[model samples]
Target: MGDYDEDTAFLGQTGPYFWTTFFLLNTVYLSTGFNGLYMVFIGSAPTHHCLIPDVNLTREWKNAIIPVTIVDGVEVQTQCSRYKLDVVRNLSAQGFIPGRDVNLTNLELEKCLDGWSYSKEIYQSNIVTEWDLVCDDQWKVPFASSTLFVGYLFGSLISGQLSDRFGRKKVVFISLAAQCVSVLLQSFSHSWKMFCVMFLFVGASQISMYISAFVLGTELLSKTMRVLFTTLGAFLFYCIGYMTLPWIAYGIREWRTLLAVLSSTSVVYIPLWWLIPESPRWLITQGRVEEAEAIVRDAARKNKVEAPPVIFKESELHSLTPSRKYSMLDVLKNKNIRCITLMCLLLWMAINIGYFGLSLNTSNLSGDPFMNCFLSATTEVPAYVVSTWLLKKYPRRALLSIFLSLGGGLLLLIQFIPDTLQYVALALEMTGKFGFTMCFSIVYIYTAEIYPTVLRNVGIGMCSSAARIGSITAPYVIYLGTYNKVLPYILMGSLTIASSVVNFFLPETLNRDLPETVEQMQECQGLCHGFRKTKYVEDEGRRNQPIQREAKV
Candidate 1:
């Protein structure tokens, strides 16, 4: 056999087996979309103000107790503070009327000591209402969101090694089960701290399931199908899941009810363990030749094709070498690889921060939060379609830089837009999200192609870990917007632009052969070094020559 690609060519490329794998894996992809972004709804802060408990006051007096404060240069009722309730009650008992009979503006104000009341028009209950995560405790809202990414950070570090040691299928199911259970637990959380703790597990399991399923699908599909799955298939399913969140939240206004609905979706995947097969490619790497052959045979039978007598050559059927245990340190060992790693880390972090920063802040944008979320998720569908087509025509680095620049440029423009034209601001933000979505999709394919095969997992893991850092910080970025409306946009825009510049220094990997070793990777050139020549053309020719000779025999 030539390589894993040629060996798998025996199975039909787009028949029963291929389509079966596509639908099964897409199910997991869909689940990830919901689990990943449910926080945007669950942790949302609806319109709220300090609660005025029953102090035997009239309706007019109750309404007048909460003080109006200037937020973002607009006068709005303060969510955290109120005119001292006791003072207000005493004044009301003395026949003091608010606004007309008394100068209420001069009354002493204090933080909401009792609790807060939330508007039930949109969200009946969210974390903001459940735990009083507003005012002095407003910081807790974003911190609760950040806890999930902290779990993501830990998951990215450990899941890959676990999958490699155990198996992709095992890790995938375990993570899925963990995610479902954790989400269920999160719905019943008695306190903010408890919810955050459970969300950590939900975050960890969500990412782990996503990564394992991604690798498993990549290993099982054909090359063309693999590109399609990553660029269009899985990503589109994720978009579909994301788009569903707003409607789900719209129907189930309570955060607990929403979590229950989302967590229950995973139960559908439990039966998929029997339908989806393990990666035969991973099996070969573990020297389980018989197991690998058996899986391929089953695939052939399912595809209605004849199986080859043997799936691997003797040389290919060996356990992974000690060198395969490459660590993250190996990425930094070489100057060229180190440079590329740092650049990728920067790009990944910026893309994630911008993407999630916009996603999480959808509620704050003008227009209905549900509609804004629907529109944001809908924008990615076209973006993925456009990106899928562009991936075939353009070089990876150039496209990445161009998209990053576009995304950053749009975000930068948002800071200068007049707030009076809120629609204009919303349009610009959506456009920016489109650009970032394209970059997000492209970078995954680009990073994989750039790294050598041996260190690919490690490199990707490091990049994902960096992305978690961005995600953890993204909520805080949104929090900054509360201080100054344009600050979050400025920070995300600036960082994305900087990363776009860094993209120019990273190598292009359009038609180049995947480097099997680090030395081969070092010789590759970036946009600064023109374009690297393809090493695979002559290898394909040589491999074809052997087949030609065999035909003559």
Candidate 2:
């Protein structure tokens, strides 16, 4: 990409082509947000208890058949254990009053042999109820959510190489189609196993679509627009999609119907193939010089600007075509690149853990589940907006550290807020969500910039794969709430705060030109940035003069 940016500067940044591409890609991102968190409603468990038969028991005996347990200092009917049904029936048959004649609590308890009764106050039916994933089977609930991330793990690994080999626009549409098909198939699942199987594909396709679109935008747009598009333009649309989820689920309580509705909306995005072009920069890197030139000329025409007779310098075009292909390992082979990659991996992991952990925990928050979800999604809007502004004004490392600390500190602060002031606790949680949302939005743009174009998607994919570990673990983190309501927040907050320190060890990427090659990666400069560049780097730099010059530019 030596002199590539300067050569294509004629294609104005704020033009019809940029807007159309930005709008279309953001629409895809919107769908990602919608589908990504559907589990919040679909997997939520409503109030349930062991089913008691009415054939032989009195109303008092039926009530006494279910055992009660104290959880979180509150007396609640136990969901799993129940009094021995035969014993309860015998007591009632003897014309004995349960409390006076016998101690109901003294009766031995057993697992729910028949089934469970679920309340329909909020959800009419969900996966939890449909598959009896409660009590003894409760682990399946979180496992179901984690299955999507498991899909994401594998998807992120391959999608980058696929997009790099095929094309971004192709991968974007292909992934969208796969996402829609998988989601539709998931809606028809007859059992938990079937649902999870489809869910894996859903997760894979969704993240592939997300990462491809992100990298496409990064390459297709100008540096000035890239920041805006990657941050507010991209995530705001995602937030818009996220905000719609609770309302959609609010109307359609059944998981199958809800998924069908969400998947059906993909039809509108089909025509974007003609509207969005392959990344001109990506094409140049592949040595498809004429094709890349034609796209830029078409963009210039759409912008009402006169096209230069020659867009790319002959020397630059020759240099753009690499002697050999690059792989994800290229990022790890260099000390500076490897250090940045490792830091980003930890950063992305922590961000995903905090982000998804809070998002999935919205259902368990104190309020109407729909309102809590909507509020959580809505918080991301301001977070993205503020982040978009902060990114322009501050160094990336500082902003990331501040945002992560702010988010994590607020979550930790909730432990001090008494349970009596629930609104206050909820507000604190939302504020914590706000902080993590900002971190979430920034990390995408940050990681994209940290890596060079040669390995941008692969680098992002690797970090994204590492990030799935956090998302995969997030459900279990929230699952900790079953034991103590505050455990999830405490753990998430602690991790967020600790991960922020890693940013201080990484280099600042604000206002810097994106590295076009591994040899062009920025030097690490921070308090603890002690990594030393290898000796072969000097020989490589002297051998590739144009790339070295571009790095300095």
Candidate 3:
């Protein structure tokens, strides 16, 4: 087959049409960023204590009804236990003061049978406060967050095959519509179980839209712009969305309103369907040459450049006519492809574990929840900026490993910071966030480059599915902080460092032509050696060039 890049060369890079498509598709990341981490606020557990009826008791008796326990060397009101109502009533009826008349600690203590009173200092309403997911029901909070990633796992698996078979543009819009409906439905849920059910769909649709748009950009943009588009353009918009979420939550201080407001933003993106065209490269793969040619011709016209009379040459038409279908299983059957897929799975998983773990744990940090989340989201701006610059100059393999190690190392150091120096710990955590953000941006470009056009979506989907496994586990990992705050950091750090070491086994793809078919994939030469690019060699002596293979190892 003819080189796809060469055939589309007439369209050129950075034209009016290209810029329109680029910006429109990347705008979807804004919604993705908002939805992905909104759970941080939606499930935030505000300070709370057991409720005490004040009908017959004095103000001091009312205060004394809630039991106090020492936590972290300081006395605090217990959330799950309170003094017995009968005993407190009798004491109050006798007009006895709490501290002066008797020792309150010696009184009978009971479970918070009357329910809990949540502090309204930070949040007016959230799933945690609304459903009372505290003490005995606290497990539901992490489980609810996990349900979204569970949906993400399933969505990744489904969207990949659908995008490959139907088309990228189709899946993008369908997922966006699904995301809007699911999130809107989620805000109205009366029970935690119902919220979780809708959350699953929200997770599924959001990631599906994100992955489809990302893969679409990879196919549509030229090599010169791909790194910037993937790293800075898309993620910076997402960072803006993420950074804005905390402020919205700050103003609203209620989960449902924040969610409804975020979900409604999707309606504005429905019109993007007309602005963005289907990938011509994908059309060519599906043997729809005329349709692909028409799109390119229109692009050339909008680019204000004359198109070549013949877009797809005779040989290009003849070679690409026999279409072959591929599946995720095909990726596993090949040794070279399987190795790359395995490494990608682990790499994406490790990145997600670090990324989501830090993001979800932001509320637990020593600061206002809104400010902590905003800082976490804001860290990505410089991360993506630096990642974009590094990606252009360094080899993908080395840069990815360095970023991963930097994240893991910073996370490990957080455990050493004294509790009194909380700002120092937070600075270390933000630096870790920066490291993971950079790695997250680079890995997308690296993975897209590793797979061939036919298997690209499926390959990325498989890796993303693995990433969901990490995302699904992230909440539980953060939950480990309840037992011991340092445990999560230790686990995340060790896994990240191991994944950094594993990244070296994968081959580099800097300045390389994207592999069009499985046969053209670059082979990783073991530890001591580098990569060997596989391509068809045209005969210099013959009038008619035939496709013959040669490998330079």
Q: Highest lDDT among the candidates is held by which one?
A: 3
Question: TM-scores of all models?
Answer: 0.91, 0.90, 0.89
Q: What's the true lDDT of residue 21 in model 1?
A: 91
Residue lDDT tens for model 1, 366-479 = 779999999999999999999999988999989999989999999999888886888999998999999999998999989988888878888988898899999999999999
> What ranges in model 3 sit over 4 Å off?
284-291, 313-315, 321-343, 448-459, 505-553
Model 3 pairs whose backbones collide: none
Query: Which scores higher on TM-score, 2 or 3?
Result: 2
Q: Superposing all C-alpha atoms, what RMSD in Å does each candidate have to the true structure?
A: 5.2, 3.7, 3.6
Clashes of each: 0, 0, 0
Report the number of the highest-TM-score candidate. 1
**Consecutive 10-residue window with the lowest summed lDDT within model 2:** 544-553
Which of the two candidates, 2 or 3, achieves a greater lDDT against the reference?
3
The Cα local distance difference test for each model comes to: 0.85, 0.85, 0.87
Q: In model 1, what lDDT does residue 395 have?
A: 97
Superposition TM-score, candidate 3 onto the true structure: 0.89
